[model samples]
Target chain A: MYTESNEKKLDEIISHYPVKRSAILPALYIAQDEHGHVTDDDIRYLAKRLDMRVNEVEEVVTFYSMYSRKPIGKYKLQVCRTLSCMLQGAEQITEHISHKLGCEIGGTTPDGKFTLQEVECLGYCDLAPCLQVNFDYHEKISTESVDQLIDSLK
Target chain B: MTKVLTSRFDLKGEACDIDVYLKTGGYQALAKSLKELKPEQVLDEVKKSALRGRGGAGFPTGMKWSFVPKESKRPKYVVCNADESEPGTGKDRDLMRYDPHQLIEGMVIAAYCLNAKDNYIYIRGEYWYIKEILEKAIAQAYERGYLGKNVLGSGFECNLYVHPGAGAYICGEETALLESLEGKRGHPRLKPPFPAVVGLYGGPTVVNNVETLAAVPWIIINGGEAYKALGTEKSGGTKMFTVSGHVARPGNYEVPMGYPLMKLINEDCGGIPGGRKLKAVIPGGSSVPIITAEESEKVNMDYESVGTVGSMLGSGGVIVMDETTDIFETTRNVTHFYKHESCGWCTPCREGTRWLYKVFERMHRYEGRPGDVELLDDLADKILGKSFCPLGDAAAMPVQSAIKKFREDFDRRIKHTLVQINKAAD
Candidate 1:
């Protein structure tokens, strides 16, 4: 079910740890990257691969906010809503993005092009009102800049 | 002004590149330690430096390293807690992104002291770009023979790897970090079998913060006394504070410990933008107590001085708030963060944070009852020291202190709700 390069990559990751079970996080990342999100089958497959119970793997997936069980939009717009960002007008930025996308905080667009999420601190509080499109950071963002960003992405 | 940890931040991204790092005296400490110093001697130097961990809890770094058993048969491990998830903190992100080799050299020196062969940097998953930069730097370190088998022809083997954590703030805690490293839920384990004695695949391990470990290379090069002389006696060495919110220049500033808090915000950060009055400051991250502007005037940027103002110098986040900010709304926002980040290991934290947020939400919407403020206080009191982990205390401290220092904000919501109820009765 894995590509040859991906499978080789997983093996290389597994080699970094002393025990095979310790590679579950990296392994899950690989699975999520291959498939848009991790599915039940992927969890079961990983369980067998890492010698862990299916529930164990499932628990790890659910525990972390990064791992998405369901498929996500092409661009995940995770706006930082913690104190620093909020102090710097993150609420307005979030509101503007939501209005522009025609989606709520947790919902995806009809076109499946974007998903809006109000994430806690992104550790870029120095650049208040920052966000991430997928894994890339957009720092010191403004409403107009967010409009430009969405337009550019579209 | 002492730029111990962040001297290379001005290099304009060249510090991440190894050639620049080496030219700027990056791995000199590792070379010096490998050639001349014994493992015990290295530990003694760190002890003399009086360096404290920059990761929220201000434990001494050398004391933490001494906890690992010297003769344990199990393979020793050195793990760097790069999971910089504390709200209002972003210093570690810059440290890793700007100077990856500095962290690498520090970890190698730590491993040498512990006689550990394998080390890992468990960075947060959202920091994937920084992780990529760190990986490239590690590859460069390997290429230069600073890492891998036979370091500097000393026959001591050291291997460093970067491990990414899926998004979980609880993983920043040492035991939880170890649990996450072991590929499980990031639930924190109990104390007594601290990670120092029993950690990382059942081996004696030493977990240090990114800033804490990054300071090691300098401590070794400049002599422990010199490093200790940079700061106050109790809290040695300079610290990196991510000063954000309402400031003209919001960025990380490296200053000696016990530097004046107001000076950091007013001078280094260029004060509040547009001459707005300062309302309050969360001197540490959001987890610490909120100090009023009156209280902030006397506070200094150190562990004890912040403690004197009923807050901690936690993670050196220094979240500044201007007069325009609504304390009620800000408190609600902080409560929501804990509510979401709580790992649900203990009932008080799990249920207590949820209850606090519900109350804060109602108060924020102006539907608060008269006793709601007291109830919020009572709920926070229940959860303060009664949880399985410090997450409970982290959630409760800010809410508790916010209520104490800024009671007017909470009372304002309650008063508005009372007026509406009286109008309905009339």
Candidate 2:
């Protein structure tokens, strides 16, 4: 169940496409924003609203790396672990954050405040060793800066 | 020096604003095309420009446009591949973030040529900020009559919207992008009925990269010949290279096609930092073959020249690695990327990438078998061109080339494992 404002937002996005199903990705974003991660109930509601099978919505949600099927931490610390980032010492950055958070890569903090993930190229290689806290990018970051970032977030 | 694609980058944050873009001669090409040039003439200019796709493949842009059926009954679509997820590629991100209007103008010109009214820019979800910037610019374009039911008082109508992908690299492939846009899994479709013929809601479609589309307005405004004259006869026009890793100046540099690879690394990028010798370079993105510094001496940043040195000018993502870098670790890292990104659509790619990654991981952990190097080479060969899309080839090329050029690195790992095993047996 989406808020009235969110429902209005979904309606507006759906109007942009000729087919209602085309808006599923954008609609999921709204639902995720409303309910943290995509819950099973959210998928069912989206399937019914968009006139699609539940499996269809589930597959799309599961296929993409960004969408979360279950609940995640408030702060998703996604470090870029691809070629360029690695060349600039992304491994050390990931390690530093992992140490600071007291969790391994792909693990969430005990308090559910932060989750660390090793993401593929974020297209910010020019600013290598970059990471994203939620949607905000922290580029060309040093281990010290990463430490500061965690402290600030905490 | 002639920044055709990134001429407005100097405007900094203000480049995204329509007023600044207007002052700096932004949408004049769109105006020129809509008023003076016919659809065929517009297309002819692009053809004469000799521009190739900037999104890795380097296919001729004009030829791709010509593939769409001219007299199609269904609504044609012009989809901009703004999914700049190639490992080292970030030029498109800059193009869209800095000069959103340039991309919009080019898209409108393309839509006019294709007789398509509805266009979508499928950007990666990670670029949510850039999406907002693009959306704001699109709003500005709509307000100024550059888009909507009529454009700049011309009868031709166009509507442009930004569509965000939910984080899948395979979606960067044209067909996979179309599939994702249709609210499905980001699995690539079979070729033959290419996007030009049957694409985007089962209509004729033309998908061009952000950098490729951003160049269209300039090609139209300054006659195609003028644009072509800027670079090599075959390559044509300037390209933006996102030079990263080891370089003192790791930033986006817009240089003419066929610019010397060494010059970019030395003069433009300030060479490898801390006096480190350049060990290897992934001239393209992670997908292209790696070239040693010795081989890179004669290489130029063009499709043909880079090809001669056994690499591609893919997405113009020049990833430099210094002598201190270990080739084995780097290859393992890259292999893991393919393993994670593989869509599992094709059996060879789906299974091959996972197996290759597992072998690389074992080798990295010093558990490599004696024939692991040859096995990786064999696996890469099997996946090279045996998949539904280029993703498999992308996954395979880097691994294959790394083994060819840096065989010693793999051999050294296997030797270390062998020695350890012998000592244990003793």
Candidate 3:
């Protein structure tokens, strides 16, 4: 279960649409936030609630990068590895985050506080080499800021 | 006094500045409507305003919102279709770049009216800049308590998140967008559980368009009646028409939706940059059928009107072709994009887009068999409605229409490709 504030907000958030399918993404977001990341059971719950075929829901949730199917660490670091971000040295930043976290590109840290994933385009070309941690987007990040942001998250 | 729609929400120096957005009239509409307007009243205004979805479909915004029954007890959603990967379409990118607040305001107001709290803008991966702009705006909205629980003490709390999509043309489709938003490959599902009925983690949803959401705050602030006064009957409000290809002024232009297509290409857009003879016009992106120069006088920037002129106003991405450009080659380029971007979710779109480009490529290379034109038409028709998504239609429409409208040009191009090659060899 999530915090009361999250639960209350999530319920109200889910009620805004007419169809149950609309709530899947939000529910997933909340579930991910609460349980660190999503699980098969969470998706199953989402499918049953939204009236979607479980297979249908699974295919979609698995396709997009934003939705984490597995439970991730506390700090879900999604570094932009698309064209613009890559042009700005996202590869180097990815390595730095990997080095700092002592994990692989898609691996989480030992303490389970940080999970690094190479995501496609965070849509911050102006401040290239961007990484979004939960709701906070750290823009124009260098290797040092990555460590600082990661350190602060822990 | 009324101020500009999207002034402060654009670029600040090189970064997307939330502080600048607050310095201006950003979030003012949500702030004002916190305690005043009920959800129905806002929906009613949108219904009255008759604002159509700006994301090509042109469905009525209020009607689409009303489709979600209020008593369902189902958690609802608001997904902004910002996946503008259409080749000629650049309007949404500009809107997000220049005035992200308009979209944020629109989404916030739409969420309030639709009785939904969570919203996501499924943006194109290529628009990394827009992601920065929108996320900052949402964060600012949260900081100001415009978002979060008990919004503005009105008990109309809503949370917003920015979800960017990999550049898949299919993802622009609402259902496909839901799939992509769910972290799946951007492939559309069969409708009827239409995304509004089943979307985003399988919840009752209202997947509104980016341009459509950006118009909401304006509709709410100015009153739907006032908003209705902007453009023509049915097709109201100013539209962002992106004109590319052989035009001198190849960029996004905001004119009334009812503005004459010729005038847009001529006056507002500074007609054909080099004064070259006009060949053809894809009046509304590559999805719509290409309009010939002869039919140039008839086109206007709207849904129904463009169809009357033997083409559709799909996304208002006007691509102008000059005399120097070959219709066969132009189509080859367009079809190739569709082919490359097809998600292979549906066979018709997957096969059809590939066949379309391949046939055009053959015709372009002067390697067409005798009945290639007829074959092109037949192939286009075969894939027309057989696919799961409109992408099949998007792939087939222009190719079939272009050949129908200008078969002679294709014929001539084949002759030129073949005969000219032989002549050069001699």
* Standalone chain B TM-score for every prediction: 0.97, 0.97, 0.92
> What fraction of correct interface contacts does each candidate retain?
0.94, 0.94, 0.07
Q: Find the 10 residues in a row with the least total lDDT in model 2 chain B.
A: B412-421
Tell me the tens digit of each residue's lDDT in model 3 across B272-379: 756688888888777888888888888777777887877877777777777876676666656765776677877777888787777787877777777788888899
TM-score of chain A of 2: 0.97
Interface RMSD of 3: 7.7
Q: Largest DockQ belongs to which candidate? A: 1
Q: Ten-residue segment with the worst summed lDDT in candidate 3 chain A?
A: A120-129
lDDT of each: 0.93, 0.92, 0.72
Local error of candidate 2 at residue A40 (angstroms): 1.1
| Model 1 lDDT per residue over B281-359, tens place | 9988999999999999998898889999789999999999999888888889999999999999989999999999999
Superposed on all Cα atoms, the candidates' RMSDs to the truth, in angstroms, are 1.8, 1.9, 9.0
| Worst 10 contiguous positions by lDDT, candidate 1 chain A | A145-154
Model 1 chain B poorest ten-residue lDDT run: B415-424
Categorize the docking of model 1: high
